[model samples]
Target: MTQPPPPPPNQPPDPQGGFGAPTPQQPEPGYGYPQQQQQQQQPTEPGYGYPQGAPPVPQPPVPPQQPPYGYPTQPQQPQQPQQYGYPAQPQQPQPYGGYQQPQQPPYGYPTQPQQPPYGYPTQPQQPYGGYQQPALTPSAPGGGKLSAQLQIVIAAVVAVAVIIGVGIWYAGSGGDGKDDEAKGTGGTTQGATGGGGNGAGGIGGGGKEKPPANTQAKMAFQVPQPKVPDVTDVSGSWITDKAYVKPGVNSIVAYDLDKGTPLWTLPLTGQVCGASRHVSADNKVPILFEATKRVAPRYYQQCTEIGLVDLNTGKLVWSTSITGGSAGDQKARFSEVTLSGTTVAAGGTDGGAAFDLANGNPRWKPQVNDENCYDMGYGGGAGLVAVRKCGPYSSQYVLVQNLNPTTGAPVSQYKMPTGVKYASVVSTKPLVVAADVGETAGDGSGISDFFSLDEKTGKLKAKITADADQYAARCRSTRVEACSQALVGNGRLYVPTEEHEGSSGEYGDETNEVIAFDLTTGRTVPEKADAGDKYTLVPLRMDGGNLIAYKAPPYDKGGQIVSIDGGTMKSTVLLENPADKSVRDAETSFSLNGAELAYEGGRFFLSETLVSKAREGDDRNYLIVSFAAGH
Candidate 1:
């Protein structure tokens, strides 16, 4: 690697958006669809948010500005467990094109929900093209009616809705979710297995589970939301054959996959800050949490504790913290964590560290001797990778390193192109990285182009330039391991295109497609996964060499899980959720881009990474919602 010109003041790479700043609120779900009485709808793309062959849709008057998304100075006293809010989430990722940027409140502050955003049209806007639904029926015949397969599915949904009555899905009936209700994790593997996308970014893997005879699902169980004085971060979640593990308050709780009840509760001292996206072979994961709970004026604590949790047995097999040079003997803090090979690594503005995944012994501590350079962060899973920044802050460049997990040494290193402010490790094994060169990604997604590199030799393979407005992938500005919404597998990168008008321009028909890019050639693949109309498809993870995606529900339909074959891109619907209003309401409550979602053994799990204090009229805010189908 070239060592460029030298000698200037050194500073860490800075990305846009200061930590803890308030972001805007989101549009509401469930708008009504306008009907066309006489004429047939035709495919049109002349303009966005417009119906074909109809007069321009009237835009509503802009609403009042919403408050920021952090907690107030005076926190609200939460109500009893039985009286939480239901589905009316105040702050979420914006609809249409908002990127799911990572936003954490400053140390002690919780997010305070602001007033509602601008009112949407009474009739929801339709967004899509006339692409045929992949893995299912062909496109709509003439009018805007749904496909034959969808019609049948709707009928089946109604039948099941009558049988189940949406009664089981609501939070009111579920237990209050007290800590005592937990069935302790036996400290054993429990025959569990890691369930996640490939080494890339995704949370769940359903490749091994066979499609049920009736793919439609019924409500399995839901974990009710707990009261927080303010917005709290509980960002980690994982799935195994036996239990679905989620971090709550300062504890990690594993709940039975079939029953919403807790399997075991592993308590922690501080609140959970970060979780490993990749799970170990034996169902273990590394986590970063605070050293102590927030109190009085000292609102927040450094995310100083790094620990490995045995997911199967609910045991904190090992927990420890280390001190850095002048950065302080006061315990090093980390912004993110990952697991690779036999190592667990943590990275942040405070340098980086690694530990043996098996026993939690320190592999290395943060080094501050090199004032001109620092380890910005590391990404792991399939392999361990790091982004090291050096040179003066003015002309600093980054080296993306493929590391030897055991020694914390770079096996190979690639120098990033000049003028790159920050870089994120999308996947370590495939050696995919993303950056907003010249800060061109104005959408706050913190990505502009993807660099496919040679991990073994530290060479450039391909550079896939992504247009922020055109692509919907996200990576938090300075967190090296936080890129998401983009799936990498089968030597291809899958991302959703922006939503557009669908065939028969009608209200509420927005749609999009998942297109693939060859990592080897940096060229677009011919096959695409279309979300049909009215529904938007987001690629979740890869399953069995296929793409697992979530189909966002339209005004009257429920979400569907479809598998797109890697070779042909032909999609197959694996689970079709009920469109019944109550069920749809609960399912949509978990925002599409912001929610933590996964599927295992035919069970679909939706979870929240953060929660806040409920206002006076809040109903039953649920923390986790589960849907399952089987023989």
Candidate 2:
């Protein structure tokens, strides 16, 4: 390759004058020989570099020392180079955008040189629409070897940064593919699972837990409606045929006891169905419900008909539409109703009265001065027991009255202590046991007080308190967990009350519970209904014992059902779901023969199948399980 011509005799070739600034003029070219360029001479003054006569140009800041590249860097001087070998002469000052003619150099150097702007590349002269960017070149250092080392270092740093960034991103992405898969399948790799997974797609995550297997031979009954059911009575296995159904405004339906299926659906005819209360003394008769109906056109209409159905067949044994004088008057109501054998007794709003079972015939009617009488009880042998309250809807005391069931004649009357609100007769032969409400002073907690009465006269014989601490002392020989284990038995009552301090530091108070009471001595003892203890099964009832109780299995925070022994009283862990907090109601009872025990709760039925045989042994315990078909 031919080398480029050298600079002219009077010119210098350095292009490092901070770029973009004007340079001295170029020299003329020679034929066959290298052209020459005229160079501006540096003035002798300090911090100045320019020829004797030239246009002024701005210079860079005063550097600490002269830069290594020998180039003009002065700002104030106006010096210009003369033609080669020629004497200095005055010349016209050039305008900012004007160019001067080239002058010949005295000796060896190229002419017509150009300088580039600071941090910019020089461009070839071409006709174009706009500026074209120069190709980018890698930056180089002062020395060749050092520049190569710097390049190597930068490449390494960049590589390392990219690697680190990728690693951080991967870590922050959370679960791996396998983890996600596991979550999708409810934390398992099982096939076709539906629900939130353990990681991302858990099978049971968002899906509801699988219900327990239903294995009972007898099918369990369902509420006629899936909403809050109006529970009337537990009369002989929950028969739900239409005959037993009370027409409700919402088309209410009850369930059948044997098949656990919905019974008859009665068109409520736009009236709210009432709930049944309890079973009669014979255990075969059920005291069903009665409510008034409000017909349309007028805002209110008096209800006259009372329905009495056979427990077994749901057959309408009797229905009586009572007639009160006025249409809007509510006093034409059948306030309370009950049954004895084939006879149905009803208390009317006008006065106390009883009706016949075979037909809507009045058996007897009695006079009651008080208008707002609420509840009535009966003793065997055709005598009436009523609870009468006084004051503006405030029940201060309970009035116990006995009337002739056949004639509805007043027999006798007695008043209980203050604050006696609710009462139920436990027996009615020679002696009668009744439950009444009482409240203590400390927490004003209400207690169920049991009382024994003389059947011959309407008189209170004895009162018993179901003190928890007292029952706990009696059961000290055995494992005692809670005070509520006491239960009432034939002609006797059992109850347990505990004195516990309030968790809020308001002073520990006892829960005075009344499970049962003894009529003869007026003493209360804890029976087995109190299963609130941590985990200790207390037998709720024994065979042939009037009182029976059972505890449902303990579950985790979640309400997954599980099987638990009624007698074990031991706590076991079941499904735990912290999100749901619902109160569970459990009822335990002995089989009709008392050979086995059963428990009922929300969609759960538990039974001790071998309890009768087991009770013969010292163990007296049997496996408890959820009833498969009956639940």
| Candidate closest to the true structure, highest TM-score | 1
Model 1 bad stretches (over 4 Å): 1-209
Q: Name the lDDT value of residue 117 in candidate 1.
A: 15
TM-score of each: 0.68, 0.41
Report the C-alpha lDDT of model 2 over 102-178, residue by residue, as the tens digit: 22221111223222211111344222212234533347566344477776786567545543322110000000001
- lDDT agreement with native, every candidate: 0.62, 0.29
Q: Please, what are the lDDT tens digits per residue for candidate 1 over residues 84-130?
A: 21211111111111334355321111123222111111333222221
lDDT of 1 at 434: 86
Residue 118 error, candidate 2, Å: 97
Best by lDDT: 1
